[model samples]
Target: MRLTALALLLALPALRADEGMWTFDNIPVQKIKAKYGVALEPSWLKNLQLATVRFPNGTGAFVSRDGLVVTNHHVGRDAIAQMSTAAADLVRDGFTAATRAQEIKVPGLELMMLVSMEDVTAKVNGAVKPGATDQEALTARRNALADLRKADEAKTGLTCEPVTLYQGGEYWLYRYRKFTDVRLAAAPELQVAAFGGDPDNYTYPRHNLDFALFRVYEDGKPYRPDAILPFSAKGASMGELTFISGHPGTTYRQQTHAQMAYARETGIPFQLRAIERQKQALLALSATSPEARRLAAEAIYSLENGHKRLSGQLLGLSKPENLAKVAEAEAALKAAVAKDPALQARVGGSWDRVAQAVARQKALLAEATYLDTGRATLVGRVAALRHAIALVRLADETAKPSAERLSEFSEGNLKATRAQLLSPRPVHKAIDQALLAAGLEEARQALGDGHPFVKAVLGGRTPEAVAKAAVEGTKLDDAAVRRQLAEGGKAVLDASADPMIRLAKAIDPFSRAIRKQMEAEVTGVFNEQGGRIAEARFKVFGKALYPDATFTLRLGYGPVATYANGTGTLAQPFTTYMGMFDRHLGWGGNAAAAEGGVWTLPQRWLDRQVKLDLATPFNFIYACDTVGGNSGSPVVNVKGEFVGINFDSVYEGQGGYYVYDADTKRAVATDVRAILEALRKIMDAGHLADEALGK
Candidate 1:
C-alpha cells in the first residue's frame, strides 16, 4: 500500500524520518527512492526476505548458496553451549569444522526461512459474530486461525504461522521452510565474542566480534538456498545508506497510555526483581569453580543482558518527557477520533476497554507471572519444576481439539514444542536447585505463603528444601524419561511418582485457572479492543503507520552516522581494531583489568597483532530502528551485499521500544571487514574467509 501525503502529514508529529520496521509487502519504495535516490526493486526486497532466517531466539541470513548462515555468537550461544562438554568446552575455545563430516550437528536446533505471507485479516475477524462476548470472540478467532493454519499446512507442507500484526488489527499467514538439522560451522571464543561483557553490552563504541556461522543440512548434506547475500569487502561507509533485514522481537509503540502505565508501574518491576534474584544465584554459583562458571555462563550472560535492557527501558519510560510524549500522542489520536463521527462511533470505548484490561492485568499479575506455564522453553534454563509443568500442561493441552488447544500446543507449533521438551541439552543440578529455590521463594513472597499455589508448591517445606528435593529426585532431567512420559499421555503423567511431577500436578489447577483468567479477561480484551483502537488509528492516520513488532521479518533502513553521546561529545560511528586492544590494555582508563577477564584479548589475536591492520573498522553504529531480536540481522547496502551483522544497541536505543530518536539512538554491528581480516590473519580460518568472500 502506498503511503499518501495525508498519512505522512497526520503522523509527522509522532513518527520520525527513519522510524518504522516495515513489512515486506508494504515497503515504501517511493519514499526510499525520493530520499536516498536508490530504487528498491521488487527483486531486491524478495531476495533479501528469502535469505533471512529466523532462529528460536534471534535472526540470521544465508551468506552462501551452500547453506552457510551468519548470525551473532550470542544468537548461537545456546547451540554452542549444548555442543560443549566438560571435556571439550567449545564455548571457551570456539569451533571450526575443517571438513563437511567434521561439522558437529547441533542438537535440537532449527532455522526457519520465510517463503511467503498472505493477509488473512478479513478471514480471522469474520470469525467473531456481531455482539459476542470477548471470550467467545477470542475462541472463535482461535478456531478460525487454527483451521486456516491446518489447511494451509496440509496443502502446502510448509510451516504456516499466524502472525498477529497491529495487536490483532490484522493477521498474516507466514509460511516458512523449516530446517531442523543445523550444524555449527564456526564460532569465536566467548571472551572475544562478548568482549567487554555486561558493562559494554548496551553501550556503543563496542569492539565485540560477536559473529558465528552455521550450515543447514538435508539428508546429511549441505542444504543449498536459492538466495544468499554476497559478502562485501568494502563494508559500509560513514553516512552511507544501509538496510537491516531481520526479526525484531517486540515493541509497544502503538500501546495506549494505560497499557504503558501498567508496564511501568507493575509488570517491569516484577520482572526486574525476578531477574535480580536469579542473577545473584547464578553469580554465587559461578564463583565456586571453573566448571560451575561453565555451566552457568549462558544463563548469567542472558540475565545480565536482559537486566540492562529492561533497566534502560524503565528509565526511558520513567522520563517525564518520554511519558509526556506518549500521553500527547495518545491524546492527539483520541481527539482526532472524537472529532470524526464515523471513527468515534466505531471505536468510542476502545481506550476505556484497554484501560479495563490493564486493571485486570494488575489484579492478576502475581499469579499469572509466577505460575506461568510456558517458562520452561527458555533454552531449558529452569529446573525440574518448570519441566514438570510443561509435561502436565502438554498432557492436558494435547487432549483438546486442535481449535481449542492452547496456542503453543496448536498443530503448527507442536513440532517445536516437542523438540524443546525432548532436547538433550545439558542441565546442571546444582544451578537448577539454586534457581528453582529462588523461584519458589519469590513466588511465596509475591503470592503470600498462604496462597494455594505457594502451599501446593512448597507443601509445608522451605523453598530450599522443596527445590532440592524436586531437582534431585525428578527424573525429568533425563531426555528418555521425558520422552516416555510425553508419549504415554495423561494416564502415565497422572501415575508418575516424581516429586517435581507431583508438585506440578498439585499446582496444575491453580495454573490453569490463572491462565484461563488471563486469556479471557486480559488478553481477549486487548486483542478485541486493541483492534478497534487500531482501526481508529488507521481511520485517522491511514495505513502508513507501521505495526508494533511481533518478532516477524521486517526491513529497516538507515544511515551509518555518528551521534551526540548526550555529554558534549559526538560519538564516532566507527571503532577500529586498535580501539579493541587499547580497551583490553586499559589504555582508555577503562575498568577492564589490564591483566585478564572479559576484555582480555584472546591469545591468538594477541599473537597476531603485528600482522593485523589495526586501523580496520572493528565495529560501527547505524541509526536503524531495531530491538532485541534483530541481533543477528544481516545489514546490507542497496546492492544487496552484506556489509555487517547487527548485534547490540546503545543505551539510548532502548527507548526505541516506544519511540525512535534518530539523534541519539544507534544500532551496533560488527564490520564485515573486521570479520574477514580476523578470519584471514588472527583466527587461522582462511578457508572459512575464502568461502565467506566467495573466493
Candidate 2:
C-alpha cells in the first residue's frame, strides 16, 4: 500500500487534482506531499483505517481505546427510537450512562471495520468477453461475482463484497469484520443536538452539537480493536490542512451529461414532490398530540432534510450557467473519445448508449416508481409489496440452479432476504395506513385506475378504505405470519387468504413481467455497456479519475477556510460557544423557555461552569470534497488528529454529487473542543471527556 506519485499520475491521467476519493492502496502521496508537504505513512494509514468504522447507514470513528464510537446524533436516531419506552424515553430525555454497566445494547444496529481489500478486476472481467452480448455479459458477470463472494467468504471468514469502481473499469473485493453488538453510551437532548433544526442543517456558523457516542461489544465486553483513533483535544485553526476519514455514501462526478439530465429532469423533481407531500403529512400527523410529535420527530426531520437536499440540488441544476459548464465538459469528453480511433471503438458509443437507456427510463420511470402492490411494512416507507414481489421472484429464481438465478436472489443473498423477511419490528399503524393509501393513490395516477393490477389492489374499494383495511386486516405485523408465507414458498403464497398475501399473489405476474422487461432492456444492457464506457473513461482520464463512491471507506482532504455569504456578509469559518449561547438567548431568556422555543437548547446547556469558556469553538466550516455519506466522519488534521465531526454540508454542497465546487460548497462539523466542553460542563461526563481527550 505504499502509494507513489508516478503510480497515481500515470495510473489516472485524467484525475483532477484535489478531486479524487483516493483508495488507501493507491493514494496520491507524492501529490499530497507536494501540495501540503504532508504524506501519510503506512502506520498513519493503519491508524486511520482502524479508527474509522461503517454503520449500516452512516459512518463513525473510535473515540476511545475501549471501543467508544462517536458519530452524529441523527445517525443514531433509529436506535434512539427503538430504545425509547413509555416511562424511559431516551429520545426525549437523551441517554447518558454514568457507568459502563448502565449502557444498553440496541439490537439490529451493526458496525463494520474494513479488514482488507484486493484487486479483483481481472478475475471478475475474465468471465465475459469484451464483445459479448449484453445479456451474455450480464449472466456471466453475475455467476463470476456470486462464485467469488462465496469462495472469498469461505476463505477469509469476513464479510466480502465486490466493489464496482470506475463504473466497470475496475473492481475490488472489500472484506469487513462485523460487530453486531453495539451499545448506546451517551446522547444529548434532541433540542441541543439539533440546535438550528432544518434551517441550520446545511448553513455555516452552525451551533449544533449533533453528536452521539456508542460502544462496540463482543462476548459481552467492550471489544477494543487494533485500530483506535487517538483523540486530540487540539482544535483546528483557519487554513489548517485537514483530512476526513469515513465512507461518503455517494457522488456522481463520473456521470455523463445525459445521466445527470435524467436525474435532474425526472428523478430529483419526482423525489422532491414526494418528500414535500410526506413532510406535510408527517407534520399534520405529528401536530395531533405531544406523543404523536415525539413519535414522528425523527421521521419528520429526515423528510425535512431530504426536502432541503433535493430542493438545493434542483436549484443548482436548474441554473443555466451550471448546465453550460456541464455541457462543455460533456462535449470535450465526447470529442476526446471520437478523436482516438481506439477510444472511439471502445467508449465512442457509450455516451449515446447511456443516453438511449436514460431515454427509455424516462418513458418507464412513472410506471416503475409508483408500481404498487398495496402492502406496507412496519416502517411507513418500506413497501411490503416489494418484499412480496421479492418472495415471488425468489421462488422463481430458486427454481433454477444457482448460476441461472438472478444475482440479487442468488444463494449469496437468499439468507439475508429470508432474515429480513422474517425479522420482527414494531409497526406504527397510522404511518403504515398513510403510506399505503398514498401508494395506492400514486399507483392509480401512474398506472391509471383502469389497470387490472390497480383495480385488483384497490379491490373496488377506495384508496383510503383499501389502505385502511390492509393495515387493519393484514397480519404482516407478526413476523411469524410473514415467515410462514416466505418459508412455505409459492404454493403457500398462492393459497393464503390474508388480504395482503392475496393481493401480492394477484400482482406477482404483472410485477414479474415488468422485472423481466427491465432486466432485458435496461439493467442488463446498462451493466455491459456501462463497463465498456468505464474502460473508455479510464483511457481518456487514466489514473486521474476517481470512481463513483460505493459506500466504501475513502480518504478526501481540504482546508479549514471561510466562504462568501450573501447579503454583504462573509460567514466566519467557525461558530463559537458564545454564539450558541447567544442564539440560545434568541430562543428565550432561560433554558426552559429556550427548550420550548425554536431550535431548542436543553437546560443543561446553560450550565454556569461552562459559561466562562463560551468563547470556545462550537462548530466550524471546511471545504472538503464530500457527499451525503460523509456525515459523522472523523475530521483530522495532517497528523490525523481529531479536529471535528463531519455532519452536514452547506446548501451549495448538495451539488457535490454532480460537481465538486471547492470554493462555495463546504462541509460543516461539530468542533471537538465544543464536544469536550459540553461533556465536561453541561453533561457532567468528566470521565468520558478525559477518555476522549486522552487525559
Candidate 3:
C-alpha cells in the first residue's frame, strides 16, 4: 500500500459528546453480523486461522480448504531470502514452482490457531489487588498466571498462553495449536509484488500487487485445514460483515495518556534515530563488502521495520486530527473518572508519575541509538563460542548422544552467524571496530579489570586499535574464520594461556549481560504498563478488551473502500499499474527507485492496460483495525471470501493501535487475482498458481 492522502482522511473528529461510549465488549458483534447478514457463529469464526510469517514480520490467512495459505509476498521474503544464493537471487529474480514437487518448504516456521479462551480475570485479580506496589503486584500477578497457565495446559490439549490484557487490566488463558509444516506455494515478481516500493508503501492509490501463497503440509501431505475459507472474485459488499483473523502483535490503546506521551516523546524518536544509524551502517557495509551485504540484509530488514513503525508513530502523532482524538479521549476519560471519587483516588498521581518517568528518560532515550554502542562486532562470534562450549559441557555431563549434541551445536552456531556473514556488506573495518570495542568493554564489565583477555585487549591500547589490528593483521576472512574455527576448535580449549583466545572467550557473557539489561528494562516497562492498564480497564470497562492473541483463529471485518476524512474528499482506496510507472518516474534519481525499472514500461503496460488486473480492483481498502502481527490477514468480502492479503498501513496507522479512524485509515492489501495471474503469467509458476486458485 502506498502512504497517501488517505491517511489524512482517516483522521475523523472525535466521537460526538452525546454518542454513548463503546468498548470492545460492547462492539455489538451480533449487530454487525445482522447488518452485514454474515453469520457470527463460532464455527464460521473458527475457520479463520491466523497465518504467522516471521521473515518480513507479518501475518496472513488460510483460504483454501486444502491447506492453501495466503499472505503477502513481503511477509514471506525472509524465508525466500534464506533459501536464495548469489547464483539464485530469489529476492531479485523471484521464485516459481513449475510443478507441485518444485515448491520450496520453509522449515522452523509455523501457522498457529487459538483453540479456546478462558477469562481468568477473577482468579488473577484475586492474587494481586489495587493496593500493592508495582513489584509486589507484578510478582503476585506472575505467580497467579504461571499457575493458571500450567493448570490450563493440563486441561486443554493445546498450548496454554496466559495473557494480561489491557496491560494488566484483565487476564485470559488462551489455548493454541501450532502447525509447523508450512511450504512456499507461489509468489509474484518484485515488480508486481512490491509495485510501488517504499515510496508507495502503506498508502492508497497503491499499485503494489503485494501478495503470496503458501500451504500447510503435514505428514507428507497438505494439511486438510478445517478453517479454510473459499475465495470469491466479487469482493465484500458495502456495510457487509467481515472478519480479519490474524496475529496482532501488540497495541498501546489502553495506555495512559502519559504513556502515549512518553512513547511519542521518548520511545518513537529514539527508535527512529537508532534505525537511521543502523541503516547507515548497513548501507556502508553493504557497499564495501559482499559478505556484509548478505549478512546485513536481515539487520537491514529489522531496521527498516523499526524505521517504518517509528516513522509511522511520529507521523500519526503529528496529524492534527489524531492529536485531537487522543486529547479528547484522554479528556473524556479523565473527566469521567474525576466524577467518580473512588476512581479518581485510585488513579491519583499515577499519570503524573508516568509523565515524570518520560521526562527523566527523554534525553537518554534520544541518545540510545542501537549503533552507537559498538556492540555488534564480536558479539556473534562470542555467542557462537559460548554455545559451542555449552554443548560440549552438556555432552560431557549428559547421556545425550555426542553426535547429536555436536550437530545441534554446530547448526545453532551456524544459523546464528549465517546472516551476519552472508550480509551484502559483510563485516567491514568500521563495524569490526565498533564490535570489538563493544566486546572489550563488555568483557571488562563482565570479567573485571584483572581478566587476562580484557587486560590484553585493553592494556594501554584502545578498542579502536585492537579492532584495526584484527581487521588488518589476520587472515580473518569470513571463509578463513570459519575454517579456522572448525579446524582449531579443540586447540583453543587446550590453550588456556592464550590471552587473545581467552579474551574472545569472555566476549559472550559480557555481550549477553548488556543485551539482557536492555531487554529487561524494556520488558519491565511493557509488563508494568500492561499490568496497570489491564487492572484499570477491568475495574472501569470490564470484559470490554478481548483476551490476548493465542495465535487463534479470529475474524475481523470492516469494509472495502477508502475512508472519508471530511468535506467529501475520499482517499480513493486503490491504485493502478499506471501509478506504479508514475511513482517510478518520480523517484528515478534514487538507485533503490531505479531497481523498480520493470514497472517503467510501455509495451507491458499497453498489453496489460485493459486487464482488470491492471485496474487494481481486488485491492480493497478498509478501516479495519490491525497491527504488526496482523500481517498476512485475509481481507475478505461480505461473502467471507478472500479479496486480498492485508500487508501494511500508512505511517499514521501506528496510533490506530488505540483508536481507529474510519476516515484517513487505510490498510494496504494485495488482490488475490493479481497474485495468481502474476505467478501464472509473469513468473511461469502455473502449477502453483493452479493450486492457489483452487483449480
* TM-score of each model, in listed order: 0.94, 0.91, 0.73
Top candidate, metric lDDT: 1
Residue 540 Cα positional deviation in candidate 1, in Å, after optimal superposition: 2.2
> Scored by Cα lDDT, where does model 3 land?
0.55
* Candidate 1 C-alpha lDDT tens digits along 1-695: 35695663343232222788999988988888998899999999999999999998899999887889999999999899888888998888888887778888987788999999999889999988999977778877877877788788899999888888887788889999999999998888887889988878888788999999999999888998889898998999977889999999999988888998888888788778888889988889889988888889888889989989988888778877877888899889889989989888878888898899899999987778777664422113575666777788899988888767877677756765687778776566878887878777878887898898888778899988987887899888788999999999999998998988887887778767877888888888998888888888887778888899999999999888767667666676799999988888874333555333767766777778899999999999887889999999999999999999999988876877876666656789999999998788876677877877777
**Tens digit of lDDT per residue, candidate 3, span 1-695?**
34563554454222111111122233445656565555555444444433322222566666666677777777777776666777776765666666657778875565556666788878977987676655455556666766677666666656666666555666777666766777776766555666655555555556676677777788888777666556664544433334565666666665666667667666777556545654665577677767567655655665677677767767666666765776787676666667777767765445555555455445433122221122232344333222333322332323443223322233222332333322232233444444455555544554567755466556767755665555554333344453444444454444433333344444434433443443334434455555553545566666544544323333455665555434356555555544565566676623444654534433443355454355535355665666676678776654556767777776556656555555455566665665655555566666655654567
For model 1, state the Cα shift of residue 471 in Å.
Answer: 1.5
lDDT: worst 10-residue window of model 3: 14-23
TM-score of 2: 0.91
**Roughly what TM-score does model 3 have, to 2 decimal places?**
0.73
Where does candidate 2 stray beyond 4 Å?
A: 1-17, 129-131, 372-380, 383-387, 422-427, 479-486, 490-495, 587-596, 607-612
lDDT tens digits by residue: candidate 2, 1-695? 34684554343322221566777777777887988899789898888987899986689999787889999988887787778976778876788889999888887687888978988888888998877877677778777877888788889888877787776668778888888888998888787788777767777778888888999999998987777665678889977888888888877767778778878888889877777766676677777877777777777888888888888787777777776777898788778878889878877787778788788877866655655232122113744544555666666778888887767677765655665566554556666666667666767776787888678777788877876776787777677777777778777776766665655666666665665566666667677677877776677777766677889998888777666656355567789888877776776655445434655565555546345487888898876777777888999987777889999888866776787665567788999998888787777577788887767
Question: Model 2, poorest ten-residue lDDT window?
Answer: 371-380
Q: Each candidate: what lDDT?
A: 0.84, 0.75, 0.55
Q: For candidate 2, what's the RMSD?
A: 5.8
Question: Ten residues in a row with the worst lDDT in model 1?
Answer: 8-17
